[model samples]
Target: MPNATGGQPPITGQVLFYKDPQPLSAENHGGLGVRQIAEPFAFLRAAHAVPVTVTEFGVAAASYPIIFVGDERTPVAVMGVRQGQNLFVDQNGYVFEDYYIPAFVRRYPFVFAADESSDRLLLCVDRAAPMVSNQPDVPFFENGQPSKFTTDAIEFCKEFERQRRATTDFAKIVASMDLFEQKTVTFQPRDPQGREVGPVQKVADYWAISEERLNALPAEKYVELRNNGALGACYAHLVSLLNWSKVVNRAVRTPPPGQAVS
Candidate 1:
């Protein structure tokens, strides 16, 4: 079962792009406002991977490798091969042009918090976000009621919560089938002269659905997966692995000095 507080725990200790997340309330932040998000993705500069909802598999697969992580088998869109480096985000905090931004990134600063006791979901915002303010721009509340912007944000968060629950269920199905396997992605590093040096470096090692195992599933189970819409998502994940090369190429073009490109 998903946690009543949503699928994962609350944002804490620099989870992804959020700095300080606080539950929205009439008393503590009735006068706060959020400046229009001019740089929608400036906060994602330091994130190499972002959680992705199941519905985004088709579009996310086209731009980044989709993989599962951790014991929960949470799906993620891989943006970089190295830690603390996001190939898609430039130094200026601008996401690369033409990339399909995930909903997880688009819904930044606002999230839904489910109260276990009351079974109620509360809308929350990151207090430390640059867009949050008190002096103007777009107020969260107008005349003691939620402003249009706040309403829209709440709607977006609600939809994301729905999708997140679906994703969690899908992950459980996949795990139950025992289709995942540990996979290692290796890269050949080059010296200053652009000549290959050292043995091939293992860039990343993570679990993914094994194609062989998937193909070997019983006919009845296979049909069940297809009927439940997991088949398409599984295929999308397999196809997205090809994009790992693209990540490596982008990193090579702007190689960080020393220690084999950070």
Candidate 2:
């Protein structure tokens, strides 16, 4: 967007995604461990391009159910024994291990916005879409009321870790989920004057992988991509689909705050 002085003014409120580079591990500290995962954004920050949030992280399988509420009201349950010890949830709430929290975030869409005052930003699941019911079928969190999935997720890792102990072959402790087929909407940002810059192409390319690869993705990985505007591809394609030049010209000619044709 342009300023009154006619420059490519600092972009305010532009949403960007920074891909995490490593698996969530004990070394970095909960959530903090994966903060550096999005290295590209680091480069931007060095150049004074601060992101509102470092939106996503990666983790292993068996952690998705703990971070999300399935469309099915009835939760998926698992139990087993280790070192002559019986590990179980006692038919109440599901128990998750900390190692998997980062991965589960990948399955759903999330948003991060800059706080403006400090370097730290806000991170949370997109209220527009949230954890689905984990019963009969998995689906999106219902309208208006975005579930506390992300909020619960933040603390879930700590609790899981506190209760966790060293044990080999945690076969019983590990669990997997079958998420429902779903669709999403993409929104391209406009310049300050509200001129649509079109979809960010690079973002789209990063997400284009085979259905097989997608199917193999754990829920957390899936949620991270989906949550971080997975629609970037479709959104970018819309420029060609809807005539990119025409849209840009229309925005320029509209005589708005950011669109004064030169």
Candidate 3:
């Protein structure tokens, strides 16, 4: 979807699956609404990684190897080793096992865009989304006010915005401490005989919190992190790194189309 104010880039860049994002308003979308879809999450099929708020580190840690990426140090849940595949989600839009679903996925088709002129947040939807219907069973508005479904969606987007702010603050705190380091996840091919074969493969490289630096911090600075709620997030991120093996193994089990399958 386009950005919140329409067509322009998102002020907040996590607009992962939105293709034609447009601000929701009674005048513009009085008749548009969403419908139930057999594959509500089909959009996630190609999204190998998605942004996650700091609050999600505790729960998302169990399912995704939470890693920091990009110049912004934005945290993302690694779903697939390759760029275009999501190992946990199948072609039919089925999520394998009981993997922790990120709120970013669940909040699809609806997002908040900032109105730069007034500095207000506007709720937007991906009009190109398969579930968005011109004649929706549940309309976006009723009697000139937002319908209950629309109201609920608005609340969800608002909560996500709140979480986004908190996550930004946490990232700043971590950056200020200079605790991030370059990290990589790799795979080594093996033969049927269970012996190592071929060259050691670098699956992906990104940023991660440095445990060594964290432990070496001054006592008062360490206490400051603990008091700021970042200490737990640091541990959560470090603990989550153990799951990188799972991502590598999954890529080996079902390598993307061009890659050699293990």
Backbone clash count, each prediction separately: 0, 29, 6
lDDT of 1 at 118: 57
Query: lDDT tens string, model 1, 1-262?
Result: 1121223234434457666777676567778987765665677866788999989999999999988999999999998776766789865667888898999888878876655455667677888888888885988888766788878888888889889999999999999999989898888989889899989988788889999999999999999999999999999999999998988778777665234544
Q: Candidate 3, 4: how far from true, in Å?
A: 11
Better of 2 and 3 by lDDT: 3
- TM-scores for the candidates: 0.88, 0.18, 0.91
Write model 2 residue lDDT over 193-222, tens digit each, in one string: 978787843211111113445457778866
| Top candidate, metric TM-score | 3
Arranged by lDDT, best first: 3, 1, 2
Clashing pairs in 3: 1-18, 1-19, 1-20, 1-21, 2-20, 2-21
Q: Report every candidate's CA lDDT.
A: 0.81, 0.27, 0.85
Residue 158 displacement in candidate 2 (angstroms): 11
Q: Model 3 over residues 1-262: C-alpha lDDT tens digits?
A: 2222233434455468988887777777888888988887788878899899999999999988999998889999999977778889875677776798888888878888876666667788888999999978788888777888888888888888889899989988899999999987878899999999989988888999999999999999999999989999999999999999898888778968467755
* Root-mean-square deviation per candidate: 4.3, 23.4, 3.3
Candidate 1 TM-score, true structure as reference: 0.88
Q: How far off is residue 178 in model 3, in Å?
A: 1.1
**lDDT: which candidate is best?**
3
